[model samples]
Target chain A: MNRRPTLWLLLSFALVLLLAFACQQFTGAEYFIDSSSCNGCGECIRICPNDAIYYNQSGKAEIDQTKCTHCANCVAICPNNAVY
Target chain B: MLACALQAQNAFTLRSDAQMVIAQSHTGVAGLNRMSWEHHFGPDLDLSVSSTLNSNDRIIPTNVQKLWHNGLVDINYRGTDFTVHADYRNTVFGASQLLGLYPTWDPLTSQKRLMQHQGTIAAEFDADFLQLGGFASGKILRYTPYTLDLDTFELVRQDNANATDVYTGAVIKVPIIKGLATHVAMDYKSGTFADNGEYDLNKLNAGLNADYKILGNASVSASFDWTKRTGAAISNGKTNLLRSTLRLRHRFSNSLAGYLLYINNSCLNDRMKNLRLMANYLRAQVQYSFPSDPTGGSYLLVGGKYSPENKADAYFVEGDYKVREKIYAGGSLNLQPDWQALISARLSYYYTPVNELHLQYSHRQYTPWNNSSLDFGANYLGVGTSFHW
Candidate 1:
């Protein structure tokens, strides 16, 4: 079988990746939990697949910035709408 | 015979769900639709392609919309004793706004998006008495970070949330007795963030699981796992976890049945310093069900979950009654801690065996244990429809 088609496909994929990376933008804004609104129901903790959210000293939910992947799953799962 | 052969070789399916939610804070509509196609090369080989679209306006607080689109392709092959499977998925998530409280937040100005690509492959072999399996999976996430200014689009920081994760695992299962089975598994996971090396970590997991059946109605299952984390990450620590569950089910008569379930999860070691995790979550639930009417479309359930860790107790009673051949009415009442309660009623109409429409109303009251001024109540009215073919 000819390998030209496979080579071309790989080349195209690499080009697309390069373009996507070049056009991407970033900022310093981040999501935080409103501690006053948090009910400590543990719903966000259970829904975070990365284990980034945990209980604080006050038993309120807190997000570990290092482990957070910005999936926004906690934002959707929090019944009290604490995550912003 | 030809039609049968064709049908066996190819199959297609479509499913869609649409819901409109009306709440005190916001009103929104959500939709999810999926389409899948499968082709069988032979009895032992097959391929499938699936696409899904999901969108919700109330996913975030106070009126933010999120849309997710995903595509997947999977292939499987089975031989005499071994099977191989592989799949790839690409997903995109877009948000209409970053923050509802922000003054500059707008649908077009402060939008965000994320793209993810994931691939997985697995192989398994069966040896009559035992089974062996292994899998490897990888994912790449690219997030469009939040912006401070919408007009100038000034990029101040690199994307810290962009990450890649790789995981591999192996498992072996053995049958010990007629109704008992045991399995041991090991997994290794590694992850890296694009701009933050402090978030990079490597983890190893080893676990054992066992399931046993006592007689025909009672079963017990348990698992013990040990996890070790290394690297510069903040969660670098070692933890041991044990989980066990016991379920007992019985049928008292032709129309009445009951089940009792108890689950316990505990951490064996307390060495983790940075994370304030839940040490234990113990819950027990007992549920009894009985037919409400002779037409068999209705039943009543009474169940309660009691947690000893935080005094979080919940009790619920639910029932559904068939009002007509195509219509049904159902309601439930749930009581929780701190005087929190939820009461809901639903009416469902079935147009066909695979299609349904439902209207539901729920009222919820939440009061925190410490603060009574933070108490709030909300009412929700939802109408949803599901169609399948």
Candidate 2:
């Protein structure tokens, strides 16, 4: 098997990391849930370390931006990839 | 999870809502109404303020009203690894556990309230491979029954029913290897009861935990803690507690996984050396997830546990099925040999991007302690909606 593709993928990942690092000073990353993709599963609400996320009346989970510590727990745990 | 996300410092967010919950059973109808507000300010120096007002009729045998207040302030300097926070909370909520520590199910009856006023401050220093943090908190609790005086016909305020707790703790964590971390934590706690000063307490606790990832897919974690508590007002009175837990998890396939856990707790009281208490529990759980598709996916979890102290076994099973992405239904069931079984189910529907509706129901069947011939249980059903801006 040709190793070129694997090498290119690694290089691309490194390039993206480098760009992210370079752009860190100008713009920071923020955490938000994409309501369009949210399933209202309430999993994120249960696993939040800060209890910063709650089920809105709509049954969808929303992040309390003030209480959120930017822990990214919900982002990692969301099965639908809804939290950003 | 970028901490350096670009955000304006002056930005603010708010959530304000009103909710009504009604539970119906064979006996009668119960109603609950609540209003809440949450506000946040600033990005660099964040401040959060929240409040809730709750009124309930038939939660217990009577009517109850409560108000809650919570606030938090966090300061994180730009381009630094130091962060600090302070918070205050006053809450009157349903009691889950006895004395806030002892595990009991008696609180399930009535609108038993555990009122707490607490304040805390903490600071942390984050560095590569290592982290250090410390915190101090104080709380006052009013856990006595809320009742009216039979003679005076007025609300009776138990003046000496309060308990005050002060605690200070520190923790350190280190990453030892790839996918492995270890932590050490220590704390000192003091408590005083207004009713009986002789029950005042001073306690010391220390704990260690280890986390390791195995085979890049499996994980193992272990935690151990030791506690020594002494009655400050009484001479030669002490209690020692030891607790340990071990958990192991692994994935069998793309959609199947399982975990095993063992927990042991033992306490020895100097005053009751003959009555040393020890409890051991072991549980095994398995989970399965279905392949995802446009119509949606589903997952199932089942677990069973054995307790030697009670000579009883318990089983739990939970599952969630997503009918496409806009609607989902889930339910959980728990059964124990000695007591009753609990069943709960919930359904959610997403009408739009910012609107949602949810319905839930639960039932628990058991025989009352006093009335052995009769089987008694409770049923509850609730519906709620969420709207966002």
Candidate 3:
């Protein structure tokens, strides 16, 4: 009949649920490469862990949508600021 | 005359990288060699052809040596407001899980023999205030594992993880203000496995991004993505994933800069009892450089990660120093719960702008989170050289 302990446990469970909900957000974004700004350095291709990036006919870097795991490795490695 | 014109318009490069790796069980030599030729037909059109060869036995845990190669052809056209590009690649290689940020928990490792042919095309149009782009890609993968057929008195290729994947996506971006921009994109992906239809899957992803510059020297960007996957192989035949990232970058002074990044990954409406993917990661770094020397710089980075579902926490610290103009050294230490740690050091000499000689050493002590008795340690020493012209 320790009501205090039950109250504490319930409060802790509520806090955990609140934290989980707060962490989930709808603020995610998509990534793309600006073809005009791309300089064909191939750095993005080399750093892609999933092998999602490749060169297109115009010699510019292009990302394969299916293979891309949305890791954003290409966006971080692009030197010309082409990836967004 | 034609040969001279072609030679004048073409640029050729050949690069070779060789590393001698010393590991506990074996001492192996890994090599990568590439040759590429690019020719500019005009200012707006270009074509390139490249070939690469690789031989490495140290990537996988086993000692089964393998050599592989790939060839690529690419072409591009850049117009005033529109850009078009296409490429094709063919590769034959042995695939394995290379050493990465996350340690493999399973001790048994096997290489998969694979051959792949991929083609992609993309186009982008810049409409002054808004940019729009779309791309489509297709790939075919063939697995090559042969077994002796007792009935036919011949060899038969076993059905393995062969699959074809198709992906298409489109994105549009709009600049709202001088320092603000937003974008929305969606993509569709499908995969068909040859061996098992139950493993086939289709995925759809939609995401949004916002970027803003706070001041002249600082910027902030955030993104959120939602993914829906459906397949018979998936747990409960369906799943939903949500991922988000926030990044802040600031240039404190002429010689000082830093950045902070945070990521949240979660699976919502989770019904699978055995699988859960939820984690939060945070990383911060500060860099300082000598004002007078462009090449002299140093940085310190620290990161931490937590997984509520798995009850795991990981931390890492990485730093580097220029030491001098031509010599540089760096080291990193990573620690995870259950006594898992990795420590690595690297030193490099830059002889010229496009040439480098380096030595790297790493030692890893790994213990599975669920199993403590399977603990093991590995040491790696690599000496490599690279040159470009």
Best by TM-score: 3
Error of model 1, residue B211, in angstroms: 3.0
- In order of the candidates, what TM-score does chain B achieve? 0.68, 0.66, 0.70
- Residue B389, model 1, lDDT: 41
B1-389 per-residue lDDT for model 1 (tens digits): 11112334477756566666555567767677877788989899999887888787755332233677768788999999999988877766666344211121123322243666667888999998999998877666655455445567663333535557666678788865444456776655555443445544444455444444445555444444444545454322324333333444565566766665443333333363322222222233333333554544577767665543334456678877778777878898877653467788988887864456788887766545422232245566677665444
Error of 3 at B108 (Å): 18
State the lDDT of candidate 3 residue by residue for A1-84, as single tens digits: 245433433443343344346654432233456565577766566555444566654557776543455565564345444554
Give every collision pair in model 2.
A28-B4, A28-B5, A28-B6, A29-B5, A57-B385, A57-B386, A58-B356, A58-B386
Error of 2 at B348 (Å): 3.2
Per-candidate DockQ vs. reference = 0.04, 0.02, 0.05
TM-score of chain A of 2: 0.64
lDDT of 2 by residue, B188-248 (tens): 5555433444334555666555555667678766656556666543223226555556677
CAPRI-style class, candidate 3: incorrect
The list of candidate 3 runs beyond 4 A from truth reads A1-20, A23-84, B1-20, B34-52, B62-65, B70-76, B94-112, B145-162, B172-186, B194-207, B233-240, B267-277, B296-325, B332-342, B368-376
Clashes counted in candidate 2 amount to: 8
RMSD after CA superposition, every candidate: 15.4, 14.8, 11.1
Task: Give one digit per residue, the lDDT tens place, for model 3 in B309-330.
Answer: 3233456677667678777688
Off by over 4 Å in 2: A1-84, B1-26, B31-56, B59-79, B93-115, B128-130, B142-162, B172-185, B195-200, B206-208, B232-238, B267-277, B293-297, B308-314, B336-339, B368-375
